[model samples]
Target: MNARQGAATSVHVASPPEFHAVTGRSFAAGTPTKSSQKSDDRLTTARLWQVRADPA
Candidate 1:
């Protein structure tokens, strides 16, 4: 699929708050694909360098 033909998706970030260790989180979204999912998953594996939180 050269052009996002299928599984089109979108994410809504109402308020991206600053990441705090106690309430820290990451925001990553994309099409339902292995690589895309993996990229998002990486940010949550052990919390590396997330600076903003999603409002969802």
Candidate 2:
């Protein structure tokens, strides 16, 4: 995911390993943005959809 704040920009990936790494880097690099929360919500929703879509 790419986000732009004025002239600043950032990218976040929702995959494991890279996901953890990117989240840590984002926090350490600067103040957390509202988009982060939205991302978390999106990830959770995506996971739920994946679970529901799977065949039992």
lDDT values for all models? 0.37, 0.51
Q: Write the per-residue lDDT of candidate 2 for residues 1-56, one digit (tens) a residue.
A: 33464324333233335455444434323445445664568788798889999957
The TM-score values for the models, in the order shown, are: 0.16, 0.27
Which structure among the candidates has the greatest lDDT? 2
**Angstrom error at residue 5, model 1:** 14
In model 2, which regions exceed 4 Å deviation? Answer: 1-40
Q: What value of lDDT does candidate 1 attain over all alpha carbons?
A: 0.37
Per-residue C-alpha lDDT of model 1 across residues 1-56, encoded as one tens digit per residue = 53443323222233333222212233445312234455467656535344334333
Evaluate model 2: give its TM-score. 0.27
Clash tally, candidates in order: 0, 0
Model 2 collision count: 0
| Deviating ranges (above 4 Å) for candidate 1 | 1-8, 11-31, 36-44, 47-56
Cα RMSD (angstroms) for every candidate in the order listed: 12.3, 8.5
Clashing pairs in 2: none
lDDT of 2 at 13: 38
